[model samples]
Target chain A: MPTLSIAELKKQANLIRQDIILMLERAGSGHPSGALGMADIFAVLYFQILNHTPHKPNSPLRDRLILSCGHYCPVLYATLARAGYFPLVELKTLRQINSRLQGHPHNLSLPGVENSSGPLGQGISQAVGMALAGKIDQAKHQIFCITSDAEHNEGQLWEAIMTANKYQLNNLINIVDCNNIQIDGKTTDIMPLLSLRKKYESFGWKVLEMNGHNYGNIIATIKQAKNYQKGPVVILAHTIPGKGVSFMENKYDWHGKAPNKEQAEKALQELRQAV
Target chain B: MPKENKNKSTRDGFGDALLALAKKDKNIVVVSADLAESTRVWKFAKKYPARFIEVGVAEQNMLGIAAGLALADKIPIATSFAVFSPGRNWDQLRISVCYSKANVKIIGSHTGLGAGEDGASHQALEDIAITRCLPNLVVLAPADYNEAQKALAVAIKHQGPIYLRLTRQNTPIFTSAKSIFKIGQANILQKGQDVTLIACGALVYDALQVAKKLATQNISVEVINCHTIKPLDKKTILASVKKTKKVVTLEDHQIHGGLGSAVAELLAENYPVPVKIMGVNDTFGESGTPEKLYKKYGLDQEHIIKNIKEII
Candidate 1:
């Protein structure tokens, strides 16, 4: 696959944002803020960063990506479809009964989805396991786990952090979508996870902070992460809860609630204009 | 009558079997949660250091790691106390292992009253209930040391998520090496027409003894060792209950969701025989010797005999 330029990647991210709005509107219920916020990161991963094949989703040499905060699966489904893992038209069937696109990401139902996740604080530990396996097998494929800032409230997330550090899993790259909004309320108000960079650094992770929506920064950060050979690297991508759409941006109400037809039309109009 | 030999802990059997399997299949990996000595995973750790993962008291991480390894086409056996694995890290086991349909084996040691002297917090009376209820998880509580070893082999051979409930105390080894061991298959130790004695885990030996003692009194008892609690052997149980007309279920777990519950549910749905469920009666177990605990918890041969006599 040829490398996608930063402008092209940003355009893809905008398209993914549009898909997120449309899918959430069609489903009548889904997380929109986190999905929209994670578009640029997913675009960078599926389009340029990840060493994966859309056709051979189970190829041994392909890099593994785990979605820890599975509530934000619209971003993943839209991105995976856009990357040709499946038909983009199937994106409309999100959260429908018997659809491969479950409310939470199901690995068995979809190809390319490495781990099924819905509950918080589980994806990182699984990534640690995969990275450990990679180390044992001497496999070249890296393991990437995408988690949320709010899920850091869970004790299990810290346990996985300690594990990844103890194992010195340099092949693992954890991307934290620091959207700062959870279902209940703001992350700091709900449960203080301030000083995340320092926290990860103290946990022996190579911490990298960047503007999550900036395609160039995301690409650079991922490249820098791939170079670190000391321990596991965590890219704390600071993201707005909703990026492209103005009304939903930085609003916690859109954290879980889906847009109606008018709201989705507005969001899509804004995204299309941005593109 | 089956002679009472030297007692052996089922966890030891699991350890030995794990080591044996790891020796043959390099793909077999053991993940421990700082209970290597208690869970008997130290043997495999000592043998194959590379294949053994010491997650250091993190049961949740241990299970998640096992799921990850399973995803990578490696057979990962995660070992910890029953309470910690199914009790504390249940969500991980449910979502990561079972929901994902990962080929991971969960060895939950120190289950039931066999976790002697550790008190209620340590004992896992609700393991079978929690694990068996999960979709795509095979729950097995072996009869004795010999059966536990065979169960480990079978769990290793089988794919998907499995929870092998093991005991801490040295219970009597009733099943021999030659005993037929199959997943979801029950063993009929002895057959009788008067009443049926269905049991699992360490209590199987006690059930056998209860049968022999009852036989002397002209009360012929049929004994079935139900090692595999989930995907239960309905055929053997139904067939045995058909002959006996009366049924008594026994286990080392809570009566609500253990072998007794499985048997009761099976019989109630299919045969509808008069059943007497024998197990820990929905109460916390305090610190005590395994023998004293079993007796006090109404899981001994005496209790089984008492229940049998009352039902008959």
Candidate 2:
């Protein structure tokens, strides 16, 4: 696979960030902090890193991507639409009564979603299962599980981590959006998830720390993760809660609150300028 | 006449059935939460080591992994004690498997007081109530070894989530290999009009014993083996209850949410018959032998006979 130019990936990430702002504003209710924070990572995954095709979402040989922190599904929905999994206009129906794009990621409804996830910490275990299945079949496809720094407070996450190491699931890649802000306050004030890198390393996983907003860094770290075959890999990507918009950046208040019409215009302007 | 009854635990039947199914369908896989020998999944593990997964004391992860395997088109049978799988990891089963409509089979062994010596913590009295309430989940509590084995095959063939409850004690296997088994169909073992006895799991044998005793006393009894708790066999149950007008429901689980509650719910809405639910009454079981627990909990044949007399 030819590597995508970093400049092209950055432009794609900016467009995804703009879409996230627009979708959340249209929906009238959705998370913004983590979704905006994860734009670069999502852009890198869908455009550069992941071995997947939107045309054949259910292809047995396609790579699997599971979002453990499904509250930030706007980014995923935008990324999938931009990748042609569905039409970009369908993004307006998010969280509607009969919309396929549920407030959380629902696999049965959406074609590109690998697992339905609303409750935190469960997607990793599902990803572990998929990775283990890949191992059993000796398939070359990889499984990537995206989780939140706040979600690691769940005991099931550690349980899944242990199982991944026990099975030596080198095919599994776990990405933690270490944006620090959660629903109530900073993750440190809420649960204090300090020493996150040491935690995964102690669990026998190969830990990679990178700048989540840097497309080049995100792609390079994922490439590094794919090369390591000893056990599962966890990339702890440090990012601002809201990366593009000035007022929302690093603000815990914006963790779950959606931007208003004016705020959405401002965020979109900033995103367009950044690109 | 009933053929010579074999004495075996339903867990053994599950293990044997899973092994046989795995042989025919390579997609069949076993996922255990550190209860391989206890839940009898060790047989499959020993036979097909690569196909068996040991999640090691993580019931939540076990269900999640099974759901993942199911999504990948592999039939995964996740085994653990009843209290742990549906009891400890019900949230996982609900969200990961049922809500997602994953083809995962959850086997909860050591159901009811038949868990015996392990005491209240290990027993799964509320498993039926919890599992049956979830939509898209099929709950089955087979009567004995043969029925348990047959129920496994039926659950495996079904396309969605299923909960198969088994017991630890070696109960009487009255159902023969030739006895037909279907997912939501009830099997009528005896025909009578004076009263009806609806039982599930290990208590089905006890209901049969009480029916024989009631016969000599000139009280006719109809016995129905209701293996599938969810999707209750309304056709068979209503037919029996309409004729008898007096019903007795029995199970090894609690009286609140097990077979008794299911029958009462059905009867109240459909038939409105005089129903006597014979089961463990709003209490937990202590450490004791299976026989002692059954007697103390009012699940023995004597209790069924007495309840039938009162209801009649």
Candidate 3:
């Protein structure tokens, strides 16, 4: 794979952020905080690192991407549409009645989604199973599970962590959107994670910590994580609750709330100026 | 023919079938929650170590992991005692497997008080109710070893989620391996017109025994083994009920949501027969031998015979 410049990656992340804002505004109801927080990581993944075909979404050899924090599916829907998995016009039908772009990604219902994941903690476990299956079937495809920092609190997540490490699933990579804000309040204030990187290391995983908003760091660390062959890998990416939008950044209120038309315009303009 | 019978645990049937199934299809995997020897999955582990997963007594995680494996297109037979699988980890089974429609077979070993010495904590009386309530889930309780083996094969081939509730104590092997086994379809072991006796799991044998005793007194009884409880064989049940206006439903589980209630629900809506439910009546179980518990809870053959007389 050819190396991408830091400037180019940042420009792509800004475009993804604009799409997130626009999609949420069109859908009229969706999460904004985690979606914005995960824009750079998502950009680095879909555009640079991940192996997929937009034309052949169900290719057996394509790498699998699972969103454990399903509430922020707008980011994935927008990213998939922009990546040409489907028409960008389909983005307008997100969360509407009988729309393919449901609030949660359904694997068979949507173009690029590999599995249906709405209930938390199950998606990562399912990803681990997919990665293990790849090993069992001798496939070279990788499995990337995107999780919320708050979702890690679930006991089932630890079950997946233990199983992934026990199987030594080297092809499994986890991206944690560590933006700190959750539905109730700040994750630290509600229930402190303290140090997530150390937790993964203690569980026999290869841990990588980087700035989630920095496209260069996300791409570099993701590449590094994918290189190790011993056990599962996780990138603990630090990010603002909402990165580009001034009023929503670091605010827990915007965790699951969608931006109004005026707010969406402002957010898109901010992203455009930043790009 | 004096009802040809022998004694063997239903878990052994599951064990024998699991090992045989793995030999034919390497996709068949066994997941145990620290009950390999108890649930008889250890036999599979000893033969095919690569296909077995021992998750050490975490029922919830076991169920979730099984669902994950199913999503990856692996046929996972998750084994645990009935009390734990559906009794303790029903939420996981409901959401991860049934709601998602994963192809995972839950082998709930030691179903009913037939588990004998392990007593209430280990014996699962409510498993049928828990699993039967979920949509897209098929519930199967085989009578004996041969029936269990055949049921295991059927469960493996069936799409979506299926729960195979097995027993610990040695019960009579009434049916041969050649006996037909079909999911969501009941087999009538005996034909009668006076009254119908519908049963499942260990109580099926007891129901048959009572039917024999009733025949001597000129009271004819129909014995139906309702293996699949979710898609509850309503056609056959209604056919039996049409001939026999009185119904006697028997099971080892509680009469409320178990087989008895399920039958009553069907009968009330479709045929409105006078039904007498014979099983545990709105109570939890306690520590006792399988025989003692069955007798105390009115789930024994004697109880079935007495109930048949009263209903007739």
Best by TM-score: 1
Candidates 1 and 2 compared: the better one by TM-score is 1
By DockQ, rank the candidates, best first. 1, 2, 3
Query: In model 3 chain B, which range of ten residues has the least summed lDDT?
Result: B1-10
State the displacement of the C-alpha of residue A181, model 2, in Å, after optimal TM-score superposition. 1.6
Go through the candidates in order and give each one's C-alpha lDDT: 0.90, 0.90, 0.84
Per-residue lDDT over B1-312 for candidate 1, one digit per residue giving the tens place of the 0 to 100 score: 355568898998898888888888989998889989888988788888988888888899889989999999999999889999978999999899999999999988888987999999999999999988899999888888888889999998998899999999887776787777999888899989899988888888888888889889999999998888889999998988888899999888898977788888888789997999988998999999989998898888788888999999
- Cα deviation at B175, candidate 1, in Å, is 1.1
Q: How well is each residue in A97-201 modelled by candidate 3, as lDDT tens digits? A: 988888877765788876666777777767876776677778898999999999988887888888888888899999898888889998988889888888998
Question: Per-prediction DockQ, in order?
Answer: 0.87, 0.78, 0.47
Overall local distance difference test of candidate 3: 0.84
Tens-place lDDT per residue, model 1, A1-275, is 45698889988899999999999999999999999999999999998988988999999999999999999899999999999999999999999998999999889999889998999988988999999899899999899999999889888889889988988999999999998888888988999987999999899999999999777788899999999999999999999989889999999988989999999998889889987
For residue A33, model 1's alpha carbon misses the true position, in angstroms, by 0.3
Per-model TM-score on C-alpha atoms: 0.99, 0.98, 0.94
Please provide TM-scores computed only on chain A for all of the candidate models, following their numbering.
Answer: 0.98, 0.97, 0.95
The candidates' interface RMSDs, in order, read: 0.6, 0.8, 2.2
- The residue-level lDDT of candidate 1 at A22 comes to 91
What candidate 3 gets wrong by more than 4 Å, as runs, is A1-12, B1-5
Better of 2 and 3 by lDDT: 2
- Superior candidate under TM-score, 1 versus 3: 1
